[model samples]
Target: MNDMLQVARREIKTGFRNPWAYSFLILFCVFSLCLLVINSQSIVQGYSGVTGSMLSLILYLLPLMTLFLGSFSLTAEKEEGSWQLLSTYPIGSLSFIVGKYIGLSIVLLTIVAFGYGLMGVISGLVGMSFDSTTYVLFIAFSCGLVLLFLTLALLIGSLSKNRWQALTVSVSIWFFAVIGWQTILISVLNFLPYTWIKPTLVALTFINPAELVRLFVVIKLGGGSILGPEYYQWVDWIQRSSGSWLFIAVCMLWISFSIMVVYWLWERGRSHG
Candidate 1:
């Protein structure tokens, strides 16, 4: 535990030294503030309207930022031969990866907290009523989405032989998760039997952390108003299945699955080398 914490501290320090981290944070803050200011009229609906809009923004941006950060962090170490040097020390591979994840998660969470907190403060100042419970859930779920993508990014980094490869793959994944997946799903839904569409959509939501996060937030903010009536049934089904906890569990599953894949790939490469 102590060693893991030390590794986490090292990663945190390294992240702080990087200009990209600061840039990402600044961009997030600026965008969040702008969003709040622009949607000032909608703030009368409480946090739900604002949070829904922010969820859309987060769905698009957070995955890309996390993917780039996590991929580069690992690939840079490998390129500089630092990972090899570190292996000579007492740290195990699991500890190193977990620590890095922990450190990155902390950084990401801090960014989310500050950005949302600022939004809350601004909304309050503008006389927007507070929905503290809903606001807190939105922040928590957004952080969970970040952790999911971070794990995925590390897996991509571990699989790639170099930084360029990792970057390319990571961007591809971001594109798919953010844009391509939805396009494909929509096209497929048009052709699927009416009976199959709902179940398929539900399954797809579980498979994609981005979609799942959006759904989770939508449900928490009180059902399918944001997504229209087409999705209300899906939301109802999730509610029946006790979906809030289920969604959280599935997100944790994504993190675990990605980490397991990274460990396997890392071990295989080490053995071969």
Candidate 2:
């Protein structure tokens, strides 16, 4: 535990010292602030309008930020032979991985909070009304999504031989999750029988963290009115079956599974070489 904290602290310090970290911070703040300012004037439905807009934006940006941040975190160290030096020490690989994950998660969470909190402050100054419960839920969902992507990034980093390889994989994943996932799902649906479409879509949603987060946020915010009638039925079924809890469980499983893969790969490589 103590070793993990030390590793986490070092990772946190390294992240804050990096120039790109600040760039990410600035990008998130600027985008979030701009969105808040633009919507402040037309916030008709209290927090729903703003929250919905912010969720859409986050669904696009957060994955990109996390993928790059996570992909670079360990790969750069490996390229510099830092891990070799650390291996000479008493720290176990599991501790190192867990520590790095915790540290990066804290850094990402801080950036996310700053971006969202800045918007909240700006919205308050402009007298935009928002429901506290909905606002909190949005923040929670966003944070959970960030952590999810960070774990994935770390897994990719652990499996890659160099920073460039890690980065390439990271960007490809971001593209698939943020942009290509829906198109792929649509194509798959076109080939499936009508009876299997809904269940398949629901199963697909569980497979993609992005979709899981979107479903949770939409259901919690009561934004189903904007969805098509077929989706509404799907959402209703999900809600009735406590799908939100299941989603949360799946996210937890993803994180654990990712960490285990990282550990297994790292150990295998070390044993073979």
Tens digit per residue, CA lDDT, model 2, 158-222 = 88889889879988988888789979998999999999988998788766788778877787677
Minimal lDDT window, size 10, model 2: 38-47
Task: Assess each prediction's global lDDT (C-alpha) against the native.
Answer: 0.79, 0.82
TM-score, every prediction: 0.87, 0.89
Q: 176, model 2: CA deviation in Å?
A: 1.0
Among these predicted structures, which one has the highest lDDT? 2
Q: Give per-candidate clash totals.
A: 0, 0
Model 1 CA deviation exceeding 4 Å by range:
44-52, 125-130, 190-199, 225-234, 237-242
Model 1: per-residue Cα lDDT at residue 200 = 88
Per-residue lDDT, model 1, residue 245, is 69
